[model samples]
Target: MKLARFTEQGRTRIGKIEGDRIVDLSAITGDNHSMRRLLNHYRDWLPALQAATGPMFALSGVTLEAPIADPQKFLGIGMNYRQHAEEARQAGIPIPESQLWFNKQVSCITGPFAGVVKPAVSDKVDYEIELGVVIGQRCRHVKAADAADVIAGYLIVNDVSARDWLQKSPTFTLGKSFDTHGPIGPWLTTADEIADPQDLQMSLYVNGERRQHWRTSDMIHTLYQQIEYLSTVMTLEPGDILATGTPSGIGAPTGRFLQVGDVMRLEIDGLGFIENPVIADCAQEVMP
Candidate 1:
């Protein structure tokens, strides 16, 4: 089942994405207001709801937004893709020996297809196409064998970065925490629907030119391994997200960089695509 969060009036609501329409999940499961709770207690309700198809709005009628709003934590892993890690090496950065983890301030999250504002202060904005893992339950020190069980589903993530700040600062916090940088969703596909996450094909296209293409099979650390490694350090709660690192072909590594009006479309098999227009913020507002 494809899940989404959309803006209706001035408020945000959760829904189930069906053929060209959205079934407001919040409308059916009265009093249960969030996708997180629905995933936890009413996991079985999806099929029944799918079959009970009622009035659904056309796909183009509503605006698409980030599927998971207000997740407890947004954890991101760097250099989890061998090819991407190699790209980091070519830039004179050492390949990490362990899963390199960091926090994306939740506020950076943006709707799918939303415009990504290239910060005015940094002219070196870059993009990273990654597979996002959404956890279903409270996971503490889970083993690799138990990892998949804790997963709710997957989504596409663009881990937008600011190269200059990242290279000059002691940490990556400022470079990665720009508002509207993290473009997620299009849809959040449930785990059971995806037979094997490891074998799926993924790619990114910039202005219709294929830039990065690879399979999840090439990942240096598999999704389950990422789960086990991160869970040992912190509890993976319902709605907690982990973005397994991007593949190669990012701009900075090749001496090419984004300019105003560039469009990036990233997609993974089973999970849908997210397309965003890049706009320059020449005013240089300090990141919030």
Candidate 2:
């Protein structure tokens, strides 16, 4: 099932995508609250969702929101792609022996088609199209072999960053957490739908120009390995997110950062695509 969160009329609702329309789960039963809760108890909801009937809405008419906006641990992996790491290495940044993790404040979450606010404080805003993994159950010390069981689903994520603020700290939190910097979703495709997570293709484009193109197989450490490494350090709870990492072609390497009115379109093989228009300092949005 393709799970999503969206706004129709004036209220936020959760639903399952059925071609060009979405069947509102809330209209079916009062038990469903949010996408995060549905995922936390996927086994129950998974079967229940098949019976969902609702006041449906056309996909184009409603406002799309981030699939799971309330994740507690919004984390990102740095330079996990070997090709991207090689680019960083050439730029004088050492490649990490293990996964380099950072936090992306949950408040930064925005919808797939929403306007991405280019913070007035920095002009070095950059985009990193990443494959986002959302956790289904709380687990720690997860073996890489058992990691697949805890995954709920996946989506396309834009790890928008401000280069100036990123280099100001070692955590990469300050720069990564700016409001509206994290734009994730078109919708979340369940893990069961993905036959091989490591073999999917993902790419990103800025204003019609292709900037990134690579497969998840190019990742230096697989997604399960990342789960194992992170779970060893902290509890991986339901709704927690991990940006599996981005490939090369970020603005930093070419010094071609995002400016107002630029549109970012990211696509992952099974997860679908998300297009977000760049808006300056919250001023206004440009056409998609």
Candidate 3:
């Protein structure tokens, strides 16, 4: 089932998407209308959510919000796609034998149709289209074979970056965590709905031009391995998002950067798509 968080008539509520309509889960969820809450107790609520008969709203009439707005952790893997790693190698970045991860501060989270700000201090903004994995349960020291059990589902992630700021930090946090940088979710496509996570196709388009296109099958490290690798270090909690890396078509390799007014549409086959417009940073703060 596709679970979503949306606002209609000024109130945000949890819903289950059916065709073009959103069936409200308010009565069933009570005051726990957030995706995080539902995901934490997903096993317990699955039956009720499946049998929901609440009032329905046209999907177009509501504004969809980020499926998980306040996740405990938002992390990303770097250069996990074979061709993308090769491209990074050519750009002077070494390929790691183990997984390379970085943090994208939770404040950067934004809705699917929100605007991505082109910071006034930097003009070298770039985009990386990636498959976002949302964790469903808390676990540690998980095995690759057991990873699927902890997964809630998937979504599209546009890992926006500020090239100049990126070079300043080896961790890639500053460049990756800019406000409005992380655009995820039209909604979450539960694991049961997806036959195979690694076989899906994903792509990105800027201003109507195809900038990146690749399949999840091209990933050098599969999603299961990533989960296993991460859980070995720390507890993987529900609502934690793992951006499973982007493919070879990111703008950074060619000097093609995003500018104000450019719209980035990122799509992952079964998970759905998120299109965000690039807008100028209008904040008056002075950059030293």
Candidate 4:
């Protein structure tokens, strides 16, 4: 089932998507309508969600919010795609021998259709389209073979970057964690619905022009290996999002950066798409 978090009539709720209509799950969840709660006890709620008969809302009437609004961790893998690694190399970054993970702070999370700010401090905004994996259960030291068991579903992630800040830190936290930089969702397409996560076709378009297009098959390290590598170090919890990696065709190599009017649309086969517009950051508060 496609599960989503949305707002209608000024109240936010969770629901299941059904052919342009949403079957509200709020009634079943009662006061505990957070996506994290649903993911934590997904097994227990699955049956009820499958048989839910709550009120349906027209998809256009409600605004979809980030599916997992406040995940404990929002992480990303860098250069996992062979071609993207080559592009990164062209931009003076070395391809890692193993998974190169970074944190895209949870606060950077934003709704799929929200506006991404082009911070006044920098002008080198760019986009990386990636497959986002949502963890369903908490586990540590998970084996590659058992990785699939911990997965709840998948969604689209636009790993927006500020290239200037990116070069200042090897950790990439600063560049990748800009507010509204992480645009994920449309909804989570449960793992059971996806036959092979590694074979999906994904792409990114900037203002109707295709900028990045590649398949998950191009990944240098598989998602399972990434999970194994990460879990070996720390616990993976429900509602944690893993941006598997981005493919080639990011703007950094070519010197093209996002402007105030550009819109980024990311899509993955079976997972749906998310489009976000770029807007100027007008906040007057000074960090200094």
Candidate 2 lDDT over 1-288, as tens digits, reads 888998888888888999999998885445445677777667866667877767789998998889988888899999999889999999999998778999999999999999998888897999999999999998999999999999988999999999999999789999999989999999988898999999999989999998999999999989999999999999998989899999999999889999999999999998899999999785464757
lDDT of 2 at 147: 97
Query: Comparing 1 and 3 by TM-score, which wins?
Result: 3
The whole-model C-alpha lDDT of candidate 4 against the native structure comes to 0.92
TM-score of each model, paired residue for residue: 0.92, 0.95, 0.97, 0.97
Please give, for residues 1-288, the per-residue lDDT of candidate 3 as tens digits.
Answer: 999999998899899999999999998888566788889888998999999977999999999999999899999999899999999999998999889999999999999999999999887899999999999998999999999999999988888989899889888999999999999999999999999989999889999999888999999899999999999999999999999999998888888999898999988898778999999897896869
Task: For each candidate in the order shown, give its overall lDDT on alpha carbons.
Answer: 0.83, 0.90, 0.92, 0.92
**Residue 229 error, candidate 2, Å:** 0.5
lDDT by residue for model 1 over 1-288, one digit each (tens)? Answer: 888877666556667888778877655666444667666664667666566464466768788888876788888888878888888898889998888888888898998989999887888988888889999888799999989999999999999988897877656877888888889998778898899998888889889998889988888989999999988888889888888888888898776777789999999998878999998675745767
Candidate closer to the true structure by lDDT (higher is better), 1 or 4: 4
Judging by lDDT, tell me the better candidate of 2 and 3: 3
How accurate locally is residue 264 in candidate 1, as Cα lDDT from 0 to 100?
Answer: 96
- In model 4, where do residues sit more than 4 Å from their true spots? 285-288
lDDT of 4 at 120: 93
In candidate 4, list every pair of residues with a backbone clash: none
Candidate 2 C-alpha error for residue 162, in Å: 0.5
Query: What TM-score would you give candidate 3 relative to the actual structure?
Result: 0.97
lDDT of 3: 0.92
* Backbone clashes in model 3, listed as residue pairs: none
Candidate 1 Cα misplacement greater than 4 A, ranges: 9-11, 31-33, 44-52, 282-288
